[model samples]
Structure formats: C-alpha cells, structure tokens
Target: MRTLHEAVLDGLPEDLAPAARSQGGGAAMTGPGTTQSAVSRGQQARAGRAGSVRFAAGRALPLFVRGRGSGGVRPAFTADALRALRARHGGAPVLVRGLSGAVLVLLDRQELRQFYEAGPATAPAPALGAVPSRAAVRAVIAEEARHLTAAATLDLVRARHAVARAARRIVLGGGGGGCDGEGGAGEEHPAGLFGRLRRRGAPEGHTPLGRSAAYAGRQGQVLRAMDAVPATLLRTLLLLAAHPAEQDAAAAEAAGSGPAEDLPRLEACVRECLRLYPAVPDLVRVTRTETEWRGVRHPAGTTVLLPAHFHQRDPEHVPAAHVFVPGRWKTPGADEDLRMAPFGHGPGRCPGDRIGLLITTALCAEVLRRRRITATRPVLDPPGPLPVALDPRGIRLTLTRR
Candidate 1:
C-alpha cells in the first residue's frame, strides 16, 4: 500500500519537491482557504460545489479502472461518466478524491489547453534516438503486408502477433524477415535478445547489468508500440470496411504513384479513426506546482485526469462528433488543434507517434491497395452512431483481391 505522502509526490519533478512540501502539507485545496477567501463569491460557490463524494465513489472509480482495462468497450464507459459529470457541472473543473489523492477533472476545452501548455505539469519529453528512418520503416511495412496478403482472411489476432514481431525488429533491431521466420526463436523472447546483446559486448563500456537494463527498456517500448499500433490499425480497418465510399477513396489513393507518406486521404482516415477511438483514451497528469484554473487554486501534488475520449467526441464542440469524417483533418490547423489529441499534446506527447502513424498508414495502404476489405464480425452500421467501444479481439476482416 502506498502512503498518502508518497502518492502525492509520485510524479513531482525533483526541483519542485521542496516547494510542494512547504505549502499547506501538500493537501489539495478542496474549498476556499484563508488566502483564497478574497476571490469573488461566484468562484467560491463554483469551487465549493465542484464535485461530490458520492460521484467519486459511485461513478468515477469504477469507470476509470474499466477505461484503463483491455478491450474496446471500456473507453465508452469512461466517456459516459465524463459526459454525466459535464452535464452536472456545466463546464467547470470538478474536484474529486481519486484513489491516489484529490483529482481535478477539466471539462472545458480552453482549460484543457491551458493545462497542456503548462510544461512543468506534464511529463518530460521522450528520447527518440532508436526510431528508424522512413525507408527502413517502409521496408518493414512492405514485408508485413506481404505476410497479410498471403493469408486467406486477415484475422486481427494473427495481425497483432505479426505487428509485435515488426515492432520488435524496428525498436530493438535485427529481426529483418517476414512474420513467419524472421530472427528465429530469439526474436520471440526478450531474454534471447538480452543474451545476444551481452555476447556482442556492451556499447560505450556499459556493464552486463547496465546492458540488461537497457535491453529491458527497449523491450518495454516494443511492447507499448505493439499494443497501440495494432489497436489503431484494427479500428482503422473496421472504419474503412464499414464506410465503402471512404474505403474506395482510400484505396484509390493507396494505388497512386505518390509515396505512402504523402497520401493525405489515407492519413486523414487514420487520424479520423484515432479521433473516434484513441489508443490511449485517458490521460493523467500530476501537478508539480500550484496551478489555477479560472478562479480555483489546485495545490501541488493534485492528480489531473483528462478523459480524451470524452472531450474529442463531445457533440457540443466537435461537429459530427460520432460520425466518421476524415475530411475534418484536412482543414487548416486541424493537426495542431488541441481539441483532438490522437497522440496527445505538449511535452508529454508520445514520442513514437510518427513511427506509429507510419506503420499503421503503410499497412492500411498496402491492404487497401490489393484487397477489398469487408468487416465480418461485430458488424458496424455506417449510418448509425458508431459504438463507443470496439473490441479489437472480436474484429474480423475478409479480404478480396481488388
């Protein structure tokens, strides 16, 4: 079990530790304090009635856990919870006690943007040294596509395994072959890779233990990419299969003479899929210093939760929020808009986003280029509002030669 103090300091930057401790025992402000009493009456009322204990215990905890679980339906549950909260609070930030500590949930887009722009509150930028070049990535995608094309029907389960192998090759290096017989049994196991690194001798005089740790870190990166890339690809395929017109348009673009990276229509489809079903549906940030939103003051060590799934699909802000419209991304400044966080925003954004996008887009293009895809399982009706959750495991695609 974690102590309250430890939970409060979980993600605090080292430099801010002293200041956080010095301020009011690091307890998050739930009501107007002596210093905060000077604020206007309206702010006080809003702060005082921000969130309810019943709401936190009855609704927030379960939905949050479920949202973090595997499978597609969990995110929908989370989005529903946020929608209810927004209805009650009417765009004000809600302060509820999370399992860790006090959490402030931001509902307004502008407030969310402010929080994202506050650099110190976000996690540090990720290291991108191991990411491969475009040509190397394209080669991996082409090889994977060949494996898919050879199959009679593209099962998501098998595709996920193949993507894992490709991710391992891309991240840790030296798997370089088709999905069936690439780097041998060693490529299938992290321990095998670690041993190979040890035999090759450490880089820059790193000890055996140091090399092992480094290998473990890279393995973690591969695992994350494996999860995210496959989910995004699976969802994108499902969307395309359901919307025939869009699929045909994407297929035409894929068959063009232009490079895969420059396919705007295909990329827009992928982005639209992400907007509907984000790989990381919920984003959490811990405040390292005192933060203010509107007139309320959130103490240092407060946990800030942003339900990206809810915000991106909110019908009020996003036109045709539940519908698939790839053209939305083609509009000027759409990519940079904080409203849609397919790969997140600010310093905490996923560093592997470009690589992830490349892999998914290339695979989608390859499949669309040669095969006409139809969704076979858990059928989607294009005219209706799409399901909030799509279980990737149950998704099946039948491919016919174009």
Candidate 2:
C-alpha cells in the first residue's frame, strides 16, 4: 500500500497536489485560521475504523467508517457534507483557508474567479520551448466536441448494427451476415436489439452517451485521424487530460525552456490528472506474488480495486482536498495516486489515452481562451470530469462578455 501510493506521489507534478504550500514549506494561507480543510467531525463520524478507509496521498482516513451515500455507492464525501462542512467552518473559502495551519484570506471570491488560476508560488515565466499557438488551440476546441461526440455515437450505432447482423447469422448459421438477420426475427415476432447482439458475440458494443445523430457521424473520422497522430502528440494529450495544471505549466515551459529541453516527463502527471478527473476510475491490481502495502499483510492474488475519485479527495495526499482546484496537482506528493489509480498503473494505464487526452485538452483550452474568467464552476463534490464522473451544479460563471 505504501509503495503503491508512494509511487503515485513520486510520479505526480506539483499541479496534481490540490493544497497550496507556501514558499516557507507550510500550508498556503486560506482564510483566517479557522482550519476549514475537509477534515471535520461529521466526516470522522462518517468514516470509522473498518477493513477499508480510503485515504488521499497526504490525508488521514477516518478511524471510524461512515454510512454509504450516492452514486449507487457511498461517496468519499457527500456534497451535503461539503456544504455542511463549510457551514460549520464559516462560509466556503474562509473555512477552507483554515484547513491547513492558520486560517487564510485570499483575494475575494470575485478576484479568485477563474476555471484555472495560478498562485503566487506557482507563477514563473515559461521556459523556452515549443508552444501551441492561440489559434491552433482554438481550432481544436471548436471541433473537439463534434469529433468526440461523433466518435461516441458511431461506436454505438456500429454495436447495434453488429447485434442485428448476429441475429441474422443465427437464422442462417453465419449466412451473408446481419443486414438481413432482423428480418427473420420478423416484424411481428421481434427478438429485440439485445438478442441480436448476443448472437453476434458482442462485436458491436455501444456506449450510452452515443444517442445523438451528430455524434454518430463524426466518431469514425476522428478516431481514424487519431490513429495517424504521432506518439508524442498522443502522449501529450493523455498527460494533459490527467493533469490540466501540468499541461498549463508544461505549455509555458515548452515555449520558453527550449525546443527539446528537459521538461517534466508526463507519466506521473497523467496518474495525478486521472486522480482528479479519471476517465475510468475502476482499476484492479492482482498481486502475482505476495506483497505488503502500508504494513498490511496480503497473500498472492489479492485483487485490489482502486477508485481514484474517492482517494483523490482524501486529505492526506491532497491538502484543501475538497476544492475543485486543479492547482492541487502542482504539489510534490500532489502527483501521487497510490490508492487513486484511475487508469491502473504499470502495464494497465489507459490505452485510448491519446483520444481521451485530445478531447480533454481541446475542451480545456477552448474554455480558457473563450470563456470570460472566474472561479471554478461551483462544485458540491471534489473534481471529476463533469457529466462523466460527477454531475456538478453547472459551472456558474461571473463572465465579462469577450
């Protein structure tokens, strides 16, 4: 457990760490010292000593486990708990400032408004490196949704077609294939889409989000284009998806640092980025040989399921821990995701990372350039990709028309 989490922490960039650390190496000043970090009496009451307690990189898990909540399962911390925690602590940011050492007071809510912000500690001039132009980022963003949505829809349509074809094969015992198979089921005696698919051996699996017509048309083209992209671009995309803050800093670094200067390797940052907004948080690790994590003894073949979303919010690894602050990824241990493996580490990290990153990076860049700035979209829970992982209270913006 210790080694796994440690590896996660080591690989992460400072942006992955959610909490602010001062130049003095102490916690960043939040509000006035009310100590509003996510640690709370209610949280402790919720999480009790049990066989399992999910802890973040630097956070301490509860001695007692709490009752299960939403998402068909218990959330590490419920939004109500966050609101309640804030209320108990005295307003939002003010209380959050207290979570570390002394209570902190940042610029006002309006001043601190923006989807992404750079702290004083974080701001440094970009190193001489190759940077994407403002126009290129814009083009990618303008077309990203079309491509991603289309890819998703096409996948589903193909799946549905595959199923229908399979049913035809069943009647003809592998006849010419399924375009005609549904006819045999008959307009009067329908076998249903699922039935047809089962006959074909799941050759065409569809994801739920692919319901729109527009989505279907664009997917194949984007995926094919993605196939031909260089490995470096793909790697850049995935790393950006998993670590937005790092992407921001990296872009700056790449431009000023040099054409091929020593930049932060993206692997560790990917783990942390997924920690914040995982594509698929369910990762299971089976010990081929016996291994011990965090001094806990385990025999071989231990199937350990890591839910990065839950662990990312744990106060241990991420300070402030609850805010949707991407800057959290910038801290040292902030980059770790031992218990928070989103793509599964080692050989099991996500494969479609290139596609995922391409979509995610394009989306973020668009927002930064187009949307008038402000604080993070008001989120009741910790950060995760909106709509995919956690549905947020639509990202409210105090925008100035650009």
Candidate 3:
C-alpha cells in the first residue's frame, strides 16, 4: 500500500512548490497508522518507466530514517563508544535490498502501539538471507558513510581552503580574484566570490539547502579520497558508477549462497552498529500505553526520546559499554536484543537491515584490512532534531592500499 509520504512525492510532479495541506503533512501524517495505498499505487502507475527510483525508495529517501538532514552544530561522539557500537553490530542480520522491495519505514511510536493491537513481533525474525547480499546494508552504510563522509569531505574542503590560501600566499603573496591583473597583492584570490571565499575559509554556518548540498557532496569526495576501500565494495561502487550493469555476473555469483545464516549475524551487527553509532543518535517514541522504562514513569501519549548513545552504554544492557569491541554483543539472543534494540528490536526495527549490515561489514572489513583509521576531529555528539549519521569532526584514516 502507498503511504502518506508516497502521496507527497507523487504530488511534487504537479506542483513543485508542494504545500503542507493536501500532502498529508497536516492531517494524515499526524495519526499513527493512516494508510495512503491509493496514492502509492497511482504514483507507481504514473512513474511508469521511471523505474523504482521515482516510485518506491526514491520518494522515501528524504523520509528515510536518516530521514532528515543535519541542520545545526551536531554534537560529538566519543571514538571509543562509536567503535564499540560497530562491534556490537558486527555480525547481525540485515534486510537485503531485493528482499526489502516495496517496504515502508514504520516509526518507533507505530511499532510500540502495534505491540498492544498488532500482536507483538517478539521473535527476531531473520532479516536477510546471505545470497551475497549487501543492498540493505549498503543503504544504511551509504547513509552513515555519507554522514561520516560529508563531515570528512567538509573537513577536507575546509582544509583545502587553508592549503589553497597558503599556497596562494606563497605564490603571488596576494589575495585577489584570479581574474585580476597582477596590479596588486593581497587583494583577494580570483577563484570568484564563492571560489575566493572557498580558497580562504568557510563562511560561518550554512543555509538549509546549503547544508544538504554540502552533505551530499561530502560523500562524493570521501569516496574519491579513500580509494582503498573493500575490494568487493570498491569494485562494485566503481562499476556502478560507470556502467551499473558492469559486474552483474560477479554479483549474481556471489548471491548464490543460502541467506538463512546471514540473518542472525547481520542482525547482531546492525544492533551493534545502532548501539555504538546509531544512524540517528536519538530516537523519539510517543507513549501509546502507560509504561515504565528503567524506573521512569510515563503516561500514555507522552513523547519519549531514546538516546541510543546513552541507552546502548547503560550498564544494564551492556558491560563497559563505551568500548568498540563487537565482541560485547557476540552472543545476543532475540529476547536480549529486544530490550537493547539497536536497529530497533521490534517491528520498528529498520526494514533495510539486510542491506545495511552487508554494507557496514564489507566496508569495515575492508577498512580494517587496508587502512589505518585514526580520529582527527571530535565524532558526532548527541543528536538533535536534525540528526545525521556523520560526526562533524573528521575521523582521519591514512589509507594504505593493500
């Protein structure tokens, strides 16, 4: 069935400047389980040859758990803690993209409510079967990687400003636009108003769209910067970049393995990732039924935000939670994971887990093998409303390609 989000995406074609009224932002989205099946189906029909890009995940990407872009000064995450999180998620189950076809993201509140009315989805159902899958994992990792990468690329770009400034000072001993004749020195760098400013340094905070574009470009630069990624992942990304169908045979061959075993490990890995470094630092769930969590009292309908960073580290769920030793959660069971939901334990757990795990595992494995990772800047801190997957400060890695 189509969702309110799907309806909104459909509306965009007729009116680029989409208002909040008819699109369900004001009415439909407020309720927990309002369906928009008609809109989704209609859009799918309209999208036609546009393929899945414009129909399914295409419209949902913005609302994708990463959901929104980072708006302001993002806090910093401790390197030890984030690493520990990665370890926890090391071998957990995840949803492969193909398996995840036509899925929708159900938020925490929705999942919690479903517990009472919808029969609890207690048992940890296997997320992804192996079959050389990495799509869901890829999606999440792509988001997170983009988050990290955006921060890194921004850092690099900022650094380039300094480096460029220094280089220019050393060369012409002047600050002027490149267009200017050699009439004076220190006038300005002629890269243009924007280019000149870029050569020098960043201008305070950015606009909303500016931030979005910056984050998007950051991923591009980071990928280019880190050439020595996982061989399989790197080759795949490169091929995808070029001819897309470039390595279908290799991918198909890899997809031949049975995926049952992959579910548990991938889930575990995803949980660990969420615990250590969740895609969203803080997750908010509005109480549907009166409940108590960790001795806290909450009336029904009260909004509660769960900070994965803090909750994951809580002594109850983990022992010495700040460290990035994937071994901590090496033996997690479905029940145990439910309490400590990383990719969200219940139905709310990210549907894209299969793909997410695949990407994270492959990337991390590649990084461990090929690069020496180091932290140059503070990692992302407690997330705010505009939370993203990246830590603004750069995590410097001197990649020595193997």
Question: Which consecutive 10 residues in model 2 have the weakest lDDT in total?
Answer: 4-13
Residue-wise lDDT of candidate 1 within 193-250, one digit each (tens)?
A: 3334445554623675665565556555544544666656767888999999999999
Winner by lDDT = 1
Query: Each model's TM-score?
Result: 0.73, 0.33, 0.34
Clash pairs (backbone) in predicted model 1: none
Q: Which portions of model 3 miss their true places by more than 4 Å?
A: 1-273, 288-300, 332-335, 369-393
Please provide, for model 2 over 1-402, each residue's C-alpha lDDT reduced to its tens digit, 9 standing for 90 to 100: 121011111111112322222221112235665342232222211111110111221122211231222111122332222323223323222212212322122111221221012111223222212222334333433443233222312121222233223223222233422344534431222132223333344333364333222222222222322221222222223334344565555445434433223324333343344554454333334445554332234456544433344445445544554443444445576433344444343334433343334433443333333332323333233253322232111222232222
The candidate that wins on TM-score is 1
List candidate 1 segments past 4 Å from native. 1-80, 98-100, 120-123, 127-131, 176-223, 258-261
Task: Give, for candidate 1, the lowest lDDT window spanning 10 residues.
Answer: 7-16
| Cα RMSD (angstroms) for every candidate in the order listed | 10.0, 18.5, 22.2
**lDDT at 260, model 2:** 26
What's the distance in Å from true for residue 258, model 2? Answer: 16
